[model samples]
Target: MGEKVLSVIPARKGSKGIPRKNVREFGDRPLVGHAIETCRESELIDTVAVTTDSQEIAQIGRRFDADVVIDRPKQLAADEVPLAPVIEHAFAEVDGEFDYVLCHQPTVPLIRPVSVDSGIRAGIQQTADSVVFVVDSTHHYWKQTDDGFEAVSSDRENRQLMEPIYGEIGVFLSHRDLVTRGKRIGGSIEFHTVDHWEGIDIDTYADWQTAESHRSRKQLVYRVTGNDQNGTGHIYRGITLADHLFEHDIVFAVEPNDNIAIDMLEGSNYDYQVFDDNASFVNFIEETSPFVVVNDILDTTADYVTALRAAGSRVVNFEDLGDGTEHADAVINALYEHSNPPENHYYGFKYFCLRGEFRYATQKSEISSVDRIMISFGGIDENNLTARTLQALAELDDQLYVDVVLGLGYADPEQLDPIVEALPDNLQVEINQQVQSMAQRMEQADLLITSNGRTLYEAGSLNLPVLSIAQNAREQKHPYAFVSRGVLSLGQAAYVSEEMIRTAVTDYITDETRRETMRTALADHDIANGIERIKQIVFDETHENR
Candidate 1:
């Protein structure tokens, strides 16, 4: 087993999303070229090679500078056959005693070179069976149910309470022995958490986006600097992008922090770790041998994402900045970033947030009684307004089931006790700080009394009409304009007495006409499908560049 790492890009003819998507130009070269260039640019692996079941892909690989190309056997090339066997078949066919193996897919057009090389290094560092690239998920996830996808963990009581990694990308590296031992890393896995630029695993056309081109992998190194908290929403958004991949060493950090911001990543079933985000971040990119970094987080998070574009990294900034962004090997940021922020700053509702269907299911249909009005504030109530919301609910009809949802991170039990004691038997306090299914709870409810952030969006997406309140200024700012645009925003309910709470509750519940009015407004503004907008921006621009 020598230090001979072989970069493997498996190009098969069967792609449901893009036709001949593998060979299509990715940046300066074709799609498969990115993988080949990664090998040469890294200067770490022994040789850069392409394993193809197709002659077309081999030609494309060589045209892009592959050192060697192997013709794959039909059995190994056939679809539905697992990728591990195909990779093993390729190595055997290639017939070299290489120590490490890097396997990447052509569809991963947005994966950063830093992540590619880092993945190989992580696998080697762990000396484990294999290392795969992954993203962290902060929310609780579960298997699909008859109703729809469901949550099985406690992270969704409110979003800030969630912490965990969901593998989104599929970059992987393995030791030759690990692969030869009839083991495709069925156990003992390691992972690396990369920035959004290094992540963004594409499956559908929508998976590729242009609106976010400003921050494609290359420029992300600039944007993420000096911003550490999940406050900027990078770690949280990064998880959704990484969960599709296998496993890895997790996080690319020059100085790693095991802060509450990343605590959720530790709970998953993979061996993941962090890399320093400093100079070594560029070093890892060189190892992957990519000519450019794709900046995936430029627009949404930090502003310094382009700092890595300076030298060794040779970054390609893909800004979704409203005006077409600066140059790079590619412009994956489908939306152009103007030099200035917009007048509203919030942009339209499209930029607000993206949530999976799992965000709203509370799974409370099992409850036979409809008298209780379930109260769930959210995961991270940076403002402890749960008491205010509950107080408002308490003064209401006094005949409802008040299931107040609070996260472990928010509100103390002492703050909630007085309101809990005043409720009638009809209003039972079932603390769901640990319940996983918020959608089920929303579905089982008579009406929702929640904040206007993601909670309002999720409720609206699910058609659960809400009596919306803005718990804080940030939360408050979002709804009035939304309500002015025909969405409902309850003002000062958190500060209102129990009497005002009961009146609003009774008015919203008893009046079907008013409830339907709010319901119609939300359904019209359901931006839940923003994933499509993102997908179109990246992949469409990548393809269009060809």
Candidate 2:
């Protein structure tokens, strides 16, 4: 028999589903915390080590009292990466030899010390290959064939033999010596069964709820992680969506970048942290993992999605980009192009992107300029053409109030400072990337002006008669379409100059009929329901799989 017992938590850096599963929050603590705490709390386990490709997770492991944290190589972080190789490599590098290796995942948040002890004891007793955990299946399973569900049992006599077990569930115990010879189990394998609630592996929002309820019921202690910024759009939308989904949704973001994007979230009234690198994406997901992981971001080959799915996670995806994408449990795409052809493509928009409650207008048109004209542009003028547009408007003889709507994306604010100060008193500029008073400003303007992007849709939604300009080659030909619809006066975005802006506004201010015509056509119905409708359509399609 080997002298010492070793437990290894394998964590890889790339995760798109349940981003940072090992580090996700359960109750009020980090998921990995629960995993390590359980191990340290275990009496049989002499040494608990964490093997990960992410430095961030290793640090969290160390902080939480893991005996040793091995910084695994990046090559093993791929979706196709296997566990035996990782376990073998970890044991090879360790100081002492081990008879058994408990490859535990942090995402299995409820892995109590008792379960750990049970698995280890069972593994030692089986003296075979390994003793993994399994759950008893309750759902009636139908195997997909040329013919649908006949009877899982061929005959009534064998009905009793159709004993169901949700095989390959959470909790696995491995004998290191046997696995070292290139095998997961000896000739035989056994299972240490766990309750469904205890093995409630988390991966999706639903699983999160179950975990929360479990913690509340059991009074399980947890350290929740909510905020941190690693350029992935994870923390940004994660906290925001949680807020929308639940009223008391306690969310946070840790260690975000030093910029306006992260700064803006600070004011969102959510619990968050901006600390030194806490846990890399790896350790978090493996620790406080979810049951059904829903991935809408990162790449398809991301090991986070692959590993969880491999480990019996119900992996679902909501895609709008199109098909030729990676495999998923179920896909919900509400894009327009997908409907006509249906060639495994998601053509229109994403389901998760929610629009606010629809608010429409009774004022019809509220152009609030006494003598001067209103010049409105979008939040992100990636091209700094605002100054040029303003310069052209300045030459006009008419008293012009060019309301420059500044976006958050434009860089080099030092340059904008003087341009703002030196502007004519008649010309007022406003900057708020959040668009606080966006609707009011849009309605109050004499004629709307903006890019051919989402702002076009927004302006149309508001029935704000527009004077449009194309910001790019793709938009150049189409800004005219808005003009043709009479909702906006099109000045070719690329070729249009200040002369064109002044000329267009001169025409829009003069012709009130055209503005009304545009409003009547564009504001026929509320487009704000697009987001909810999007959600409905996706749910309708995906639920059909069941």
Candidate 3:
């Protein structure tokens, strides 16, 4: 059999930095329990022992299946006393004549069993007297000279070019003889680098909070409603913000719907719930008690926002045009322009939240010709604009390819299928539904026919000239789609005749200078950084009280 190895975990009862730090609850167990449990689970170590002065810590160590619990002497239990004597006492209590000994501190609960096994393997393979875990310093080291502070090394060089300085994280492995000599790391030391997060040794309240930030499963709850009438813009906006907050747990609380909104939620790896009534929604909110509640519905009422605020949630609303806008902590209305906005009201083109694909997208090479025409009304084109636009595109005798991009809510096949089947051979029209790469489709197209909503901004981001038609009066007020913004607003969908669309398309397509001007205006406006700005606002509001 190979030589025996002993693991000694030094956990004293009294702690100065954090009161009752050793026996205090951390996560689900006491601080010392993590160390004891880790040692007990190690395969390389033959025995696991803990040295503690407090009887409570000793009991916890035993309950965690520590092989031996040594009652440390009063002299070794002081706040200022070093851990050398504690490890020596634990080594002496063990009867085994081990070849190597590992000194682990209970304070560094993040130390894993795999690290212990690796350290032991290095000690045995290299035949080294000691092994210790260390982490590379992140900050530039400074030394205090007689005159003032000076750089320890490379004073003028960049931090990346400077030699790395390693800091010990209180985990050491040594030969049995070194333990008796009061030395955890002796001659022939082998250094083992640990993960930066794992090397964190919690000593203060801030340290514990940092550890919790990495370990805690905090969630961000999103509440939005969408369907054919409400449109899926809210659903898209909710998920976009949720994607930015991937560091935390994300949950979507949408109102009951069987539309493409459900498909969108199912596509993503996020938890979601379909609430039937306000009572159930309120109950769910009270139960989860999320870090933040994001409402992307058209307008949130004062009573609803008040109730959410009363539930101890920082409410963030999107496109909030109701009395609730005053009650909300933050509101982003990118499409709809609001005058005399409130303190947290973020409107205009600058606040437009595009998908990740279009944020940093480059404009098309040139507005060469109007050979390819694309039509994308919002996800749920409730106005049946696709069928109408197709009818107008067929009238054009030019051999133009029409790409009809359908959303999840485009379920009116009885009307759409006949339009496609009756289209002339010269006018090549292909229907693509639920397109994943809508940005690429927009980039390739010469003219874009879209509704006044989120897709209008997406088209603007790619510098694709838009022929916008309002789905309803609500969309008609969206100022960004007006002629002033280089978008040819074709009035409301119900009132827009096929001849009107043909006239607008012919006007933009025939005039190359007008198309160029539209593209130039769009290229000047950079809206990619809006998401970051909104994220900062959310972060500030959520963490301000904390």
Candidate 4:
């Protein structure tokens, strides 16, 4: 047999911040009704009761099928009165004796039934006199002193490094003897820490809005993969999309072998998990039952997307050209434009998501002379294009300044270093690795030489003229840069000789008219607000079916 536990909710009619907030409709039910439902659903709680001075609250409690509704005394319902006496009054009016009494606040409607059970279990297992719920407070404390206001602690470390301080969540469980003595908290106390969203206590209008926002949040899972072969553009794109979705619960689901994507996701604020294979990943999706599953992997299969939809998840795929595109809820192919796309398919450059740094970057200004040039491949230069591009630039005889930005997965650093060391004095070059901001670096250059990939869109947003070389067969299929007229494509790198690269660079430098025309063409397209467009598409597609 389980220990008998009585749950008591004390809701008064008088409220200063928002008048009559106790019986107000929150979400689909009244504010106090949520507390009643939570206690009734709890496995450990035997009896659920409400003690309120208002008759309306009593009716609501009865409508929600609460076990008991006690008439709270008028004196205990005042503005300045504390909760200890009210809980005591409710316990006295209850029919039978209970081993423990739980005081649950109606203001926090986001609290789950499992949390209540956890608090009761803690009090029983630990043999504690009381169990109080708390959350980690991130605010800095200060006090007024003779020399003006000063910090309460001498430690001035960052918020993450500082010692944690806990704030009560207005919900607690105590021994029956303590409740009868009109003391809510006492010796042998145990703390039950909850999530920050679950600790919200509604008092003001703003607090009510905050609680509603948290209540509407949904779980989102991003399935992405990255490595030396496929590059990390998909991981970068996933992180960029996740950053804009701050209101929703975000999780990154990757394969176990995707170590590059795991490393990138570790530096982010969101959470991620690794599944051993496709079968395990599908099982995880079924267990999680997320609102949406975004696939950033190059192409997904029909069977995989069908399993996701069967798990009640809306599937979103990026740059997918396989059979899964037909089954996905929405497919975004910003790199590859289709002539006859399906109704759910979104293509072209308008859906391209730029990084956050480019939002505040300064656009390029036309320079009469090509004094400086920047070379950058994607996150993983799988073909060692950086070294080849550098060698091509080293042949320039004019006094030229070159900046080479290497990616995190660039493997030919030893070979590239010797080339830079052997460059002539007239060809000055600087090598940078894993830069913080690519936009900042693009602003310092007159022209950009990059692979025919997402970097072209970033440079286009800055009005920087680009000369691109296709890194592989898959990249050669992307016709946006070639058709957009903003980029001068030199075909595939394997076919193009070093002399061809040297000639292209020399012609682009001397031809100011061509550079000016390319910049003007880039100004015609708006690529910076792709994040907003993609965000709207995700939300609309996910919520429309529901």
What is the TM-score of each predicted model, taking all chains together?
Answer: 0.49, 0.45, 0.64, 0.90
Q: Per-residue error at 545 for model 3, in Å?
A: 21
Select the stronger candidate by lDDT from 1 and 4.
4
Tell me which of candidates 2 and 4 scores higher on TM-score: 4
Q: Put down candidate 4 lDDT per residue, 180-272, tens digits, no spaces.
A: 899999989999988988989898999899999999898889889987667678898899998898788899988877888988889775699
Candidate 4 has an lDDT of 0.87
Over the stretch 290-368, how does candidate 3's per-residue lDDT look in tens digits?
Answer: 7678887777789888878788777888887889888888887888676676778777877777788786666765786
Clashes of each: 110, 47, 0, 0
Query: What is residue 517's positional error in candidate 3, in angstroms?
Result: 0.4
User: Candidate 1, residue 9: CA error in Å?
Assistant: 18
Q: Candidate 1, residues 104-221: lDDT per residue as tens digits?
A: 7765666667667777776677776787777765665687899998777744566575666567565677778766764456566787777654566656656655313523432122
Scored by CA lDDT, what does every candidate get? 0.56, 0.57, 0.80, 0.87
Better of 3 and 4 by TM-score: 4
Clashing pairs in 3: none
Deviation of model 2 at 509, angstroms? 2.1
Score candidate 1 by lDDT: 0.56
Best-to-worst ranking by lDDT: 4, 3, 2, 1
Model 4 superposed RMSD (Cα) = 3.2
lDDT of 3 at 185: 75
- RMSD vs true structure, all candidates: 13.6, 20.5, 12.6, 3.2
Off by over 4 Å in 1: 1-236, 244-258, 269-303, 306-346, 351-354, 359-372, 379-383, 479-487, 492-499, 538-546
